[model samples]
Target: MSQATKRKHVVKEALGDFVTPTEKQQIVKVTGSRGNNLHEAVTARGVTFLVSMPPKFRKNLWIKRGDYVIVDPIDEGEKVKAEISFILYKDNIQYLQKQQLWPEGFTVEPDKEPEKAEETEKDEDFSGSDDDESDLFVNTNRCNYQYSESGEEDSQEEAS
Candidate 1:
């Protein structure tokens, strides 16, 4: 049959609704295309649960990298078990993408950073003393003669 018709078969199992999804481990992956409700989930227990189309696909899309799905004690027609998985996700569309679990075929580039130059120790290069200030001088010319006139008031006193 055509793709649309083939999808209807995947939704409801040919064997009828006896699919038990309880503590059967979590659905590890979902594989199928859009407008196509038919998909299968490989559970942690290694058994694949043929998720009934449309309703189940809509509901079970939240089966992410880590989540628990419990099968209803009884089947509710094409929508056998309600996921409680809905409680895990805040939005519906996000739940779908997360459920796909195909980590490959996707690209993640490293974050860009501004490059920094490596630093090195610089040489100190200091001189011992300031030679420019030591070279300055002013002349003082009175060291050979002493002032000794009139220490006795109006009398000529000379060094004897």
Candidate 2:
């Protein structure tokens, strides 16, 4: 009888599972792609930056706008760009959420649409009567917010 030896295979672990992200890496939301291996993304802290895709990433990962990704900054200099390190997936997001490592304001709430509608309904159903509605509108126009140009004032007024 001939016996065959079993081979042990090395398995790679997913991000946030067996291994945690490095300090240099930051989670970012892909706002849009600028084409030519470049993309516009925003960090969890609301910092906007442009990220570049290297040949390896471009070939390996199928990235697109509105995808969450982990990036490592090129350097601590004037350049406001990073290298795409990991493309976030559903399982990765769930792992982050479970570990409480997910960034604030970036939580993927399952029932966001229903929650938003409930919040709107709650806002509309204020206990105070219509007579007290005017009191809720606080006007701070007297504050020192001078508009340099008349056009600026018009735009600001229109925005308010």
The Cα local distance difference test for each model comes to 0.36, 0.70
Task: Give me the candidate number with maximum TM-score.
Answer: 2
lDDT by residue (tens digit), candidate 1, 15-113: 233322235323334433223443344444455444533353453233442233332222554433322221222232234336653223221211111
Error in Å for residue 117 of model 2: 12
TM-scores, one per candidate: 0.23, 0.55
Kindly list the per-residue Cα lDDT of model 2 for residues 1-160, writing each as its tens digit. 1111111111122233433368878788899988888889988778998888765555445678778888889876364579877778778877877877777867654547579899888887875435666556667775756556568778888999
Q: In candidate 2, residue 58 scores what lDDT?
A: 51
Worst 10 residues of 2 by lDDT: 2-11
Q: How many backbone collisions does model 2 have?
A: 0
TM-score of 2: 0.55
- Kindly report which residue stretches of model 1 are placed more than 4 angstroms away from their true locations once superposed: 1-28, 33-36, 53-160
| Number of the top lDDT candidate | 2
